[model samples]
Structures are given as structure tokens and as C-alpha cells.
Target: MTKPVAIKRRIGRPPKEDSVETSNRIIDTAAQLFAAQGYAATSMEQVASACNAGKDTIYRRFPSKADLFGAVVDRLRAGVLENLENEINTIADSGDALERLRHLAKWFLSVNLRPEMVAFKRIAMSEAVVFGSAGQGQTDKDPIMDRLVGVVEDAQRDGLLCGDNSTVIANHLIHSIVFGPSNHAMLGGKQYDDPAIRDQYFDQAWKLFLHGAGQ
Candidate 1:
């Protein structure tokens, strides 16, 4: 009679795989839609539809549209940040200050000029202009900019560059190297579409940067 004993199955939090999979799908779909439609026009419902997910799914993961958009922006920048850190490590053995910065600058432009990044930047900048910040998990400090400043400071210590403020020096170099190409690409300018032309532009910019900031 003591033959059968019933065991209760554990009911707890679900496996992380499902949550992660859904999160990635939502983010990827939102990125494409926001990039294609502009942030103002893209809606959560559209994102959910693209993800083949319910609206509740998005709301559960991200509290609001701003939150979801911020997630998209964060993920894009995070990926580039990781790659840029790798680029920094890859060039750590280089002895020339300007040359080291040159490698970093090239990597920066190549990654940021990707169509998806350009779209995200355009939207994020628009958000910042109106809201004073790209709210919800965004910080005013640019980690890449901080790392750029570090490189410039190291160059200054080596007397490879001259500047009263290495921060300003680094800022000038980055803006010169990135702003024109980034702005043009964001506006759909076709001039830098070819890698050859892009490299030519970068080389010319690097030379000019050296002339102005190198010692």
C-alpha cells in the first residue's frame, strides 16, 4: 500500500535561455525598424510584430518605448566599445604615438560608419537634443572618449604630441577624424561608400591631425 509517492515539480523562474533569446530578437528587430523608420515613427507594436512577439512581452522586458529605444542604442554602442577595446589591445605594442592613434582612429571610423550605427547615432543625437540626455541607462561620459584621452596623455608624456590639455588634444583629433565622415554618411552621402575612398579620406585626415597636434 506504500507503493506510490507523489513528488511535486519545482515551479520557479524559467530558464534564462528563453529570456535572452527573446531579448535579442526584440533588440535586433527594434534596431532595424528604428533605423529604417526613424525613432519618432517606430512604435512598440511594430517591434513586437517584427519580433512575432506579443506587446506584453516588450512591456514586460522594457517598461516604455524610451526604454526599448535606449536598449537598442546601448547594445549598439556596447558592441562598438568592445571592438574598440580590442583594437586598443591589438595596437598596444606599437611604439609611435601618432601611429598608435592612427590605428585606433581607423578602427573607430570603420565601425561607426556601419549603416546601423549611423542610424542609431542619428536617432540618439536627436533624442539628446530634445531631452538633454539619451535617457534610461545612458551616461553623459563617453568611455571611448576617456580612452582616447588616455592615449593622448600617454603620447604627450612621451613628447610625441604637445598640448596643454590632452583632453582637448584628443577631442580635436577625434572630431576631425570622425565628424566629417560620420555626418556625411548619416546624411546619406555616397562619397565614402567605397572603402578605397574612405581610406584615402582617413589617411589625409590623419596626416592633417599629426601636423596640427604632433610635436
Candidate 2:
């Protein structure tokens, strides 16, 4: 009987990389680099090396440094906005509106205080001021402001907040709870990443907001 022919396995790598996985890895690596080094400081070669991809591959995918930076910012914004939407959507109608706001506040603070986000914020603000709209376009495109307005409307309807202008209320809430501490940290004040400091600020901000809003 002829012995079963030995199975010959290919030893070499696949001819093509998995496009989706490779693209995601590239974006992720670019995001880390951009967050850590800022847009001006991060180079395409660095991203390529970090992703284990060639310069040609990165150039073929991103075309330019601005394109790569936009992609990274888009990725970060998508994740943050998606998570915020998911959390807000899960709030029960029967639940106290202010309590929902508190939950959102906590989530917002945690996200904004993360190292990557902190770094990105520093870079974005600097670019916006110095480069004059280089980083501002991404913020203009984000739907987070709209989402926050919707939540503010809900609170108004629930009578938890007595405000006819959802836009003003939403802006106040965002600026107070989200930007206040984060901006403080950005300006070399108390560190927003510390749990104790963050929680204290959140609580104070919440109380101050409710009182100011006539909640």
C-alpha cells in the first residue's frame, strides 16, 4: 500500500496582509504616536515602523501626514462619541435626569482625563492657536455637541432642569464639567487623572450646575 503522501505545508508568509487588520493596526499605531508626540512631531516613518509596515504601504494608505492625523483623530472621536451615546441611551426614563447627568459627567471626566486624550487635547489646542484651524476642523465635525444638546433637552422636559435654551444649558454643562477640570490640568493646575481630585471636582461641579440651572 502506498503510504499517504506527506502533507506539504507552506513555510513562507502569506502573499498579502489582512487588509482590515493591517489598516486598523496602522491607525492605532498612528493614534498612539500622534497622541504621544503631537502631529508636528510624529513622522510617517515612525508610524510605519511601529506598525511593522513599509513607508510605501503607509503612504499608499494615508497619502500625507495630515491625512494620517485626521484618520487618527477621527478614530478617537468615533470611540469617545459612540461610548457616550451608548451610556446616555441606556438611561431609563424613570431614572432621575440629574442622576443620569451625573453618570454622564463621570464618564466624560474619565475619558477626558486619560493620558492619550490629555496629550491630544494639548496638541489640538496648541495647533488651533498656532496653526489657526488645523485642528479645529475636526472639532467642528464632531456630533458630541449635538448629542449633549439632546440630553439637555431631555432634562428640561423631565423638569430636572428648568431651562428653555438647551444650547446654552448644554454648553454650560460641557464647559463646566468636562472642560473645567481638563482645562485646569492642561494649564498645569491640579491633575485631573487623580481619582480623588477628579471625583471632588465632579461633585462640586454637579452641585454648582444644578443650583445654577434651578434643578
Candidate 3:
């Protein structure tokens, strides 16, 4: 009978560490490429090249281009929510709901006006046209919406507003506030660089949204 031999295990690079770093690199590269080239035009090969990895490496992290695009969208959405949360927490007094709303709106517009945000929005719009109504659900439940809902709920509870459904009201308010500014940028108009212009726009949105809901 052959003698039984113990198998020896070899130590190598940790799989977990490699996975984490590779995923991050893929996400970063995808975001940059998608923003610069638009979602439909960017390819896995380009992303892999940008990250100095193989196409198989990107595929290991994201099964398809659509999946990678979704990841990029998620990152941008998270950033918007973080900025909104920071702005909302800075509100010292509950009675200053109008002021708080103005600040939040202005900050939100500033974020939306960023080059990366503009590029992302344009890509999304283009993709929506190609994908039709079916694409709508893909954009649902953004973190920024959740943060805005929380802020609206707090205002209502503080007796600063009278909205019964804070989530719906928050959606409407944010949509109205951002629509004009985003459209203007999308049209290639001069950037709203003047602080006064931003303030005026936010003030109007604040007045309009609060006038209907204020106690």
C-alpha cells in the first residue's frame, strides 16, 4: 500500500483584498469613462484599459455594461444624498423651514450643475430614449429622495409645514426646484455662477413650495 501523504497548502495573495481593490478600481474607471463618453458609447474594453486591467477583470466585477452604468449612477446618487444630509443637519432652528429649504435647494442645484452630474444626466436621458418607458424603474428610489423625505417629515412634525405625505411632497418640491436650473444647464446656457442668481432662484422655490405647505 502506498504511504498516505499530507497535502501542503500554499500561501498567496489574499482573494478578499484583491477583490476589494479591483472592484473599487473598476467602479472609478467606469464612472470616469461613462461621464466622459456617455453610457451608451462607453465599453468594457475602455473601462478595463483605463483601469489597466483586462476585460475579464471588469466582467468579474460587473456582468455587463448596464450593470457598470448602474453602479456609477448609484455612486452619484449617494454623493447627492450625503450633501443633502449635511445641509439639512446644519439647520439650527425648526422655525426657519423656509431658510432651510432655500439652502438645501441652492446646494442641490450646485451639485446638479457639476460637470460630472451634467454628463451623467445627459447619458441617462439618452439611454431613456433608447430604452423607452421601461427604463424609468431603473432610476427609482434614489437616496437623495429618501433624505429629502426625512427633512420634509421633520418640518411637518415641527409644525412648520402641513403636508400629510411628506415623501410625495418632497418629490414634488425637489422636482420643481431643480427643473429649471438643470434644463438651463442642459441647454448650454451660461453657468449660473453668480451667487445672487442662485439665491434668487432658491428663494423663489422656497417661497412657492412653503407657501402651499407652511402652517
Measured with C-alpha atoms, the lDDT of residue 204 in candidate 2 is: 90
Clashing residue pairs in all predictions, respectively, total: 0, 0, 0
Window of ten residues with lowest summed lDDT in model 3: 130-139
Compose the digit string of candidate 1's lDDT tens values, residues 1-215. Answer: 68688898858755799889999999999989989998889899999998899999889999877788878877887887788788889889876876787788887788778888888778766767532334644556999788888888878888888878988888898798989999998888878879999999999998888886566
**Superior candidate under TM-score, 1 versus 2:** 1
Cα RMSD of all models vs. native, in order, equals: 3.7, 4.6, 5.8
Tens-digit per-residue lDDT, 96-134, candidate 2:
776776787678888887777787788778776533433
Error of 1 at 17 (Å): 3.1
lDDT for model 3, please.
Answer: 0.75
The residue-level lDDT of candidate 3 at 27 comes to 90
Model 2 local distance difference test score? 0.78
Q: Would you list the clashing residue pairs of candidate 2?
A: none
What count of clashes does model 2 give?
A: 0
Task: Please list all clashing residue pairs in model 1, or write none if there are none.
Answer: none
Per-residue alpha-carbon lDDT of candidate 3 for residues 1-215, written as tens digits (9 for 90 to 100): 99889898858654898888888888998888887777778888888888999887778778777777877777777777777777777774644664565566667778888878888887777788533432335646567777767767767876877869988887788787887888777666655656688778877876777675556
Top of the candidates by TM-score: 1
Please name the candidate that would achieve the greatest lDDT relative to the true structure. Answer: 1
List where candidate 1 sits over 4 angstroms from the true fold: 1-13, 126-137, 213-215
lDDT of 3 at 105: 64
